[model samples]
Target: GPAATWDAVDAYFGPLVGEDDVLAAATTRARAAGLPEIQVSPAQGRLLQLLALTAGARRVLEVGTLGGYSTIWLARALPSDGALVTCEIDAAHAAVARESLAQAGLAGVVDIVLGPAADTLRRLVDEGVEPFDLVFVDADKPSNPVYLDLAVRLSRPGTLIVVDNTVRGGAVADAASTDPNVLGVREMVDRVVADPRLDATAVQTVGSKGYDGFVLARVR
Candidate 1:
C-alpha cells in the first residue's frame, strides 16, 4: 500500500515536471550496460534541480556519477557558464555517464572524474579548488561520513551539502546495528549533530526508489 501510494504520487507529479529524452536514453543505456538501477527517481531529480536553481548554484560537486542521471538534472539547472564535477569509481559507470552527459548536451558542463571519491575530494581540497555552492554525495553508502567531511572542506558558508540514502529503510534508527552502511549513515548524523558549523535536518521520503531520505545541511 505504501509503495502504491508512492507510485501514485510519482504518477501524479510526473507529467508536471515532464520528461527528458536524453535522461530517458541515459537510463536505458545504463540498464543495457548492466549498471544498477539505484538512481534518484524523477521527482527526486527534479527536486535537486529546483534546489540548485533556488540556491543560484554556479558550481556543483557530485560524489556519485552513476549514468549521470542526477548530474544531468543539476547541470541543467546551472547557467551555461556554470561547472559541475562528479566522481565515480567504476570505470564502466563513468564511461556510461560520460556518454549520457554528452548526449544531454552537457559534455562541456560536467567533468566526470574516475577514481575513489575520497581521494578525489582530498585532491580538490589540496589543490585549493574553488568552493562549491552545492555538493551532493550519493556514492558508497559506507563512506558517507568521510564524504560529508570532504564536502565541508570544499564548501563555503551558505553552501548546501546533500547526502542521499541516509535513512536506509529506517535502519539508521537501530543503535545496535553493526551493518556498516547503516552505521555509516549514523556516524554522519552524529558528526552533523556534534558539529556547530552546520544547520541540518533529515526528511523521510517514499518514492519509486522505496523508503529512504537524505540529509540536507547548510554550512554556517
Candidate 2:
C-alpha cells in the first residue's frame, strides 16, 4: 500500500519537475531491447540532474549505464564541451543506451565504455584522466568497496561521490546477514568511516523504488 502511494506521488509530481517525453522514450526503448527495468525513477533522475547542475559538473563519471536513462539526465546537465562517461558490461545494454542517448541528443557528450568496469577505471587512473566533479556508482553491489576506493582516487578536493542502493531494503543494518550485497554495503560503510580522506553519510529513501538508500560522500 505504501509503495503504491509512493508511486502515485512520484507520478503526481513528475511533470512539475520536468519528467517529459524523452525520458519516457528511453524507458520504452530499454524495455523493447529486453533490458532490466532497474533504472532509477524519473524523480531520481531529476535529482541527479539537479545535483550535477548545482555542482557545475563539467565532467561526470557514472559506473553503471543501464540503457543510459540516468546518463541522459546527467549529460543534459553538462555544458556543450562537458562530458559524461558511463560504464556498461553488456554489449546489448550498451547498444540500447547508444540509441537512447542518440535520441536524447547526448551521444556526443556521453561516452559508453563497454567492458569490465574495474579494468576501465584502473586505466583511467593510470592515464591520469581529469578529476570528475561528481561520480555516481550504481553497478554491481558486491564490488561497492572497490568502486568506492577507485572513485575517491579519481576525485579532487571537492568531488562528490554517490553510491546507489546502499541500504538494500534495510538489510545492511543486520550484522548477521549473509547476503553478499548486504555485506558489501556494510564493508563499504566501514571503509568510508575509517578513511580519513572521505566524509560520508547515507540517506534512507522510500519511493517507487521501495526501501533503499544511497551513500553520499565528499572528498576531503
Candidate 3:
C-alpha cells in the first residue's frame, strides 16, 4: 500500500473526474505489452495535472519518465508553448514512453532524456537551462536527496517540488524499518523540513495503486 489517506482521497475525487477512455486504453496496452509497473492511477494522474495547473508551470522537470502516463497529465496542464523535460534511465522504457506521449498528442510538449538521471540532471544544470516552475521527483529512492538538491537548484522562489512515494507503503513511518529507501526518504524529509528556502508538507493517500504518499514543497 502506498498510503491509506490516498484511498480516502481517491474515493472522494474519483467519482468526480470523468475517466478518459484513451488514457485508459493506453494504460491497458502498456500493461499487456509487459512494461513493468509504470502507469500512475487516474487519481494520481489528476493530482499531477492539478499541481501543474496550480503552479502555472511553463517549464516542468520530471525526474522519472516511466510509461509517460504522468507526463501526459503534466503536459496537458501546460500552455501550448509550455514544455516538460523528463528523464528516464532505460532507453527501451523511454522509447515506449515517447510512443505513449505521442499517442496522447503530448510528445511535442515533453523532452525525454535517456541516461542516468543524475547525469541527465547535471547536464541540464550545466546547459544553463532556465529554472523550472515545477519539479516532480520519482526516480531511484537511494538517489532522492541528490535529486532534491538538483530540484532546488533548478527551482525559483515559489516553484513547487513534489516527491512521489515518499511514504513508501508506510515504511517511512516505522522507526524499525532499516530499508535504505526508507532511510533515504526520512533524510529527504528532514532536509526539506529544515531548509530555510522551502515550505513543505507530506500528504498520505490510497487508491487502486495502493497506499502512496507524496511530499510537496514550495521554494521560498
Candidate 4:
C-alpha cells in the first residue's frame, strides 16, 4: 500500500533531517487541545524550511499557522532579526500556536494575526508593510487564487510563493471535477501559468499525508 510505503520511507529518512523537539511538542499540544491534525508532516515542514533558506528569505508571510508547526520551521530559516507574520482565523488555533511558538523561542520573531486571512492581508496592505521575501499559502483551499493574488501583491520581484495541497492526488488534471478544493487549485495553476509576472511549477509529493502537490512560484 502507498500509505504503508510512505510511512516506511519517512521512518527511514526522517532522521536524516534530524529530530525536532519543538515540532514534536507543537503537534502533541495541538492534539491534546483537540485541534485538527492537518498540519504538514515533518518532511513537508523541512521542505518549507529549505525553500525559505534557498530563497534567502528574511521576511515571511504565512496564511496558516496551525499550531505553529510549519511556522517554527520557517522561522528557524530566518536570521535573528528576521520576522514572520502568520494568519489564522481560528482563535483557538491561534492561541495554541502562540504558546507553541513561544515554547520554540520564536515569539520574539513571529507575529500571529487573528482574523480571516483576506482581511488580515488587506490590513497588511493598508499598513504599507514591506514586501515579504517568501509567502506560504495553506489556508482555505477554495481561496487559493485569492491568496496567490495577495501573495503577489505583498511580494517584490524574486519573492517565492508556495501554495500547499494543489495536486489532491492528481485530481487537478480532471477539468470536470466539481470539488471546490480541486477547482480552486486548478484555477490557481491556470492563473499562474498565464501570468506575466511569475515563473512557477507544480510538484507532486507523497508522504505520510498521502499524495498531493504544491505550487511554487517566483514573482518576476
Candidate 5:
C-alpha cells in the first residue's frame, strides 16, 4: 500500500525532472536479459548525479554495476574526459551492463570489471590508481564493511562516498538480528563512527524502492 503511494509520487514528480529515453531503454534491455530489477530508483539516480556534479568529480568508483543503470547516471555527471570504474561479480550481469552502457554512449567513459568486488578493489588499490572524487558502494550486503574500508583506501581527502541499502527496510536497527546483511550494515555503521578518517551520516528513505537508506561519508 505505501509502496504504491510512493510509486505514485515518483511518477507525479518524475516528469518535473527530465526523463531519458536511453535510460528507459536500458531498463527494458536489462529486463529482457533477465537481470534483476534492483537498480536504484530514478530519484536516487538523480541524487547521485547531483552529488557527482556538486563534487566536481572527474573520477568516480562504483562497487556495483547492475545493468549499468546507476553507472549511466553517474557517468553523465562527469566531464567528457571523466572516467568511471565499476565492479560486477557476475559475468552475465556484466555483459548486460556492458551492452546497456554502450547503448547509453558511455562505454568509453565507464569500465566494467567482472570479478569479485573485494578482489577487484584490492587490485585497484595495489595498482595505485588515482584517488576517486566520489565512490559508490552498492554490491553484496555482507561485504559492506569491507567495501567501505576499501572505498576509503581508494579515496582522497574530501572524497565523497555513498553506501546504498544500509537500512534494509529498518532491519538494520535490530542489534540482535541474525541476518548477515543487517549485521554487515551495522558493522559498517560502527566502523564509520569509529574511524577518524571519515565524517559520515545516514539518511533513511522511502520510495518506490521501499524503506532502505544510504550512508554518506566524506574523507577527512
Candidate 6:
C-alpha cells in the first residue's frame, strides 16, 4: 500500500493515541532507507496491545521487528518482568528499530535476533526456550505456513497466534488469483482453518494500512 494511503487512513481513524510522532518519524526514516513496509497501523498496534493484555502474555515472540512499532506495543503490555523476542533479517532496519524502541522506553523489554527468522526460531526452540504466551508472525509471505507451524510448536495451549497481511490486497479471496504471495496466504488460511489444534478467524480491516487483513488463532 502507498504511504499516502496509509496517511489518509490514519487521518480517518482519528488521532493516534501514544508516541505516534515517534512511530511516524521512525517509519519515515525506515522508508527513506529502502526498508520493506513494516510499520503497523496505530489501530493495529493498539489491537496487538489489547490482545497481549487480554491473553496475559508474558513471553512473546514476534517474527518481524520492522522499526519496532508493533514490538513497542507488545512489550508495553508485558509486566515488569515480561520480555519480547523479535526477529529481523536486515541489520540496518533492526538498528533503526532498536532506536525507535528505545525512544518508546521499551528497549529493555525487547530482544532482537538478527538473522533469517526461521533459523532464529529453530535456534530458540533447540535452546529449550519456554513456551510463548503469544506469537505474532509478519515475515515473508511465502513462509506463512511454515511460520505458523513453528509458532504452534512454540505456543502452549490457549496461546494466541496472530498473523498479519493475510488478505494480500484482496488476492486471497479469489480462488483464481495466481499471484504467488496471494496463493501462499490462501494456503496458510486453509491450513489454519483445517487444523484441529487451532481455532482461527480472519478479519478484514481498512485503515492507514489500506485494505489489509489479519488472522487470529488460539492454540487448542
Which residues of candidate 2, in runs, are more than 4 Å off? none
TM-score of each prediction: 0.98, 0.98, 0.92, 0.98, 0.98, 0.90
Q: After superposition, how far is residue 202 of candidate 2 from its true place, in Å?
A: 0.9
Candidate 5 Cα misplacement greater than 4 A, ranges? none
Error of 4 at 32 (Å): 0.7
lDDT of 4 by residue, 141-206 (tens): 999999998889999999999999998988989999999999889889888998999999888998
Which lDDT value does model 6 have at 142? 86
- Candidate 3 segments whose C-alpha is farther than 4 A from its true place: 1-15
Note the residue pairs that clash in candidate 2. none
lDDT digits (tens) for residues 14-98 of candidate 3? 6775458667766766676677884667888888889999889999999888777788888889999999999999887788788
* Reference-based TM-score, model 5: 0.98
Candidate 6 residues lying further than 4 Å off, grouped into runs, are 1-9, 16-21
- Clash count, candidate 1: 0
Tens digits of per-residue lDDT, candidate 2, 12-127, equal 98777797788899999999989999998888888889989999999999999999998998899999999999999999999999998999989899999999888889999999
Ranking according to lDDT, highest score first: 1, 5, 4, 2, 6, 3
Candidate that would win on lDDT = 1
Q: Cα deviation in Å at residue 147, candidate 1? A: 0.6
Report the C-alpha displacement of residue 73, candidate 6, in angstroms: 1.1
- Candidate 4 lands at a TM-score of 0.98
Across 1-220, the per-residue lDDT of candidate 1 in tens digits comes to 8999999998899888766788889899999999999999998998899999999999999998999999999999999789999999999999999999889999999999999999999999999999999999999988999999999999999999999998889999999999999999999999999989999999899988999999999999
lDDT of each residue in 7-81, candidate 5, tens digit only: 888889797655599988888999999999999988899899999999999999999898989999999999998
- lDDT (Cα atoms) of all candidates against the true structure: 0.94, 0.91, 0.85, 0.93, 0.93, 0.86
CA-only RMSD, every prediction: 0.8, 0.8, 2.5, 0.8, 0.8, 2.6
